[model samples]
Target: MDKSAAQNSAAFLYPPIDPFDQRMLEVGDGHTIYVEQCGNPAGIPVVVLHGGPGGGCSPAMRRYFDPAQYRVILFDQRGCGRSRPHANVDANTTWHLIRDIELIRTTLDIPRWIVFGGSWGATLALAYAQTHPDRAAYLVLRGVFMGTQTELDWFYGGGAGRFFPDLWARFVELIPEAERTDLVTAYHNRLFSGDMLAENRHARRWCNWENALASIETRSPGGESPSDYARAFARLENHYFANGCFFEQDGFLQSNAHTLADVPGTIVQGRYDMICPPKTAWDLSMVWPRGTLTLVPQAGHALSEPGISAELVRVTNTLRSEAVALGL
Candidate 1:
């Protein structure tokens, strides 16, 4: 599609709406997370999980669902966005996030609700649903990430680098020759180092590497993210990746696909996604039984990509009619 067509298709998002309720919920481990509720209070409940393992929710995320038909819940995971103790990874893990989701659910009195997520968010959604299968009414996932070592290797271990040699070089050039072999660990060391300047410098490089590859339209590495956002995003992401996302084993989500056999889902993937490739989404659909995978041609990985945003909105709009059937 041409630039004009792509810009026009971007209008798929619902009209902007303000949150009717917002607050900070203390989720233990000395952490407090920011949570907000938008749209109809009595409408079907759907929680939005942002990516990065640290990428906090944004107002645009609230625009994906119709305000009159759904209650959208968005929160910043521990140490990111409005969440407290920014950039600190202590006591943060996949399991802690799942517990926080449960806490939010029970606290809101939502017996069951639709789970919407993408990228790392998709990883959490699957883990959360499988752990508490009865709490998920349905799932709307995009850019599937299973948190396996192979997936990690593809992105950080040079598989993706083969395709973007220039960006990969920029990403690795900062580290010493000996440390170039494991960029994640190398970046992890600096990201956590006590020197704020060095941390922020490395953090920007880490984030830029991912951001440049996020969209296919980009001709350059793009601009650096603000130091604060970069620190949180890079640190939390590297922390999770270095630890294998706190999973019991690689392919944990895929091995447990049976748990979601009865939970119907829709996976929206980008045909050219460099961040979370489409193959994982395809692999997921094969075992999910009830899951439907929709690949958006010519799109890359960003949530704002026109094709991706259009399909996600289309999926949510279609699900509105099924709210009653889903026991929303």
Candidate 2:
């Protein structure tokens, strides 16, 4: 409710720590991803995938796992954060990301790992696990999104628009009236227009719209984001969405849940998440074996939300004890 109270609420998170190791890994396609490792080098391996497909990993990501019990890995996906050739989407695709994850895993010499991700990160985690089920020992997902056309439409089409009409109008208003029918396409043009000023302006508006709805307590769109960060984030996210995240059809990820039958997963969702609604998470749990969904009643989509943070930290701690008994 208040600043001090809010701070106290999220105290479940480990205090922030600097990365014990950081490097720019060459993952081919002329792309070198940014990767970092924190916590104990010999701790139970946990790869932390960040959201946005572009929301690069942050120092706070390292706090989700207990430093003594989990070896946390964080990386900036291709074309984002500290990764090279910022915002360039030439070879970026869901499959490419899946391969990159494997490369990171093999390079680090981790036999297997617990996959932890949220939002778009959740989507990537699911894709990676389904592709390499044997490589993922456990999955801890938050604000689950399957990256289907319907999910994309719900957020960018008129679904989330109905709830946040004012913000929606501002978002759609940036494009020409003729182009309003397909907002993503319209924004894509400006985001990759190669005009720095145009890209920055549109990127800010795009990032602001999402940031505004990320938390239940947020009333106003956040202040302007850094131009470089916003541009890369907007471009890469738009690139993915514009291509339907390179899926065969809608609900591809959920349809492939059977592939994760041997993999146990914990899905943590925000009941009121405006972007990736609760229906997707509920649907996935019903179909996946040993999959459990925990919905936080008062939360939204942000990782920083107190309730969401608390639950994630609780999950990691619980898994730590389980890993010990299983000799992982």
Candidate 3:
């Protein structure tokens, strides 16, 4: 079905619900992330990971699961959303976030749970599941991003620019000619330039570039993100991209796909996902013995897209029946 027709069809997401528990979790390094729990308190556990490394969880995120069956957990990564010291990137790394996830699990007394994430969140879910394979019962990922340099080059470099030259030109025009060669580094310098005004300006452009290409339906550039959100999202994203997502080696997830040999996973990818194209998802499915990849036509990177949301809800609903068999 076309994007509009799919959107007009029945809503795929479950009904919205408030969190049964919420708190500020201190996970060291002077950072405390916001954690919230929704759905059945005694239901099977499922942790939701938001994208952007800095993208905080939202109310819509809580609606993907069946409230009567899955105990949903969502949290704002360090330096974003309701987390303390807003926009601060100190001591934040891929490994640190993994540690925080474990801390949340242990604190809540969850033995094992489903790991659901998309975009950068997919990157974290893979890292976390690989690090603590035993703790991950099953994996549901969308808009797969492996945090590899090639993937980074595709979006920040001229790869995605090839398709959206108009938006790309606007994004590139912000930096001088010499700095254009390394857009990520150039943006990093400005985003952390200590001038809040300059930072916000560059941050909006940085976020606008990504947001413009987030969905298949977004043809024109959207309005500027709020200064606070744009600052956090751009800074944290740039920080990670500049540092190669804090990985010891390139293609870390692919090399370590063996760790997930026993863990089954489902990857829902948009066929036209410009921010995180489907190639990475295909590569991951190839390496992951039990992984399944579902390519959704007329879809892009945004989790809210009709086709993407429908597939995700279908996957989550299917998993609900198998929860008992999986020992959830």
Cα lDDT tens digits, model 3, 71-157, are 999999999999988999999999999999999999999999999999999999999999999999999999999999999899989
Clashing pairs in 3: none
lDDT of 1 by residue, 1-328 (tens): 3476447555888877899999999999999999999999999999999999888999889989999999999999999999999998999999999999999999999999999999999999999999999999999999999999888889998998999999999999999999988888999999999999999999999999888888767746877899999999999999999999999988999999999988999999999999898999999999998999999998888888888889999999999999889888
How accurate locally is residue 136 in candidate 3, as Cα lDDT from 0 to 100? 97
Off by over 4 Å in 2: 1-9, 324-327
Ten-residue stretch with the least lDDT total in model 3: 1-10
The TM-scores of all predictions, comma-separated, are 0.97, 0.97, 0.97
Ranking by lDDT: 3, 1, 2
The whole-model lDDT of each prediction reads: 0.92, 0.90, 0.93
Of the pair 1 and 3, which is ahead by lDDT? 3
Residue 269's C-alpha lDDT in candidate 3?
99
- Model 1 ranges with Cα > 4 A deviation: 1-9
How far residue 236's Cα lies from its native spot in candidate 1, in Å, is: 0.4
Residue 310, candidate 2: alpha-carbon lDDT = 92
Model 2 per-residue lDDT tens digits across residues 179-228 = 98888999999998878999999999999989888887775775888988
CA lDDT for candidate 1: 0.92
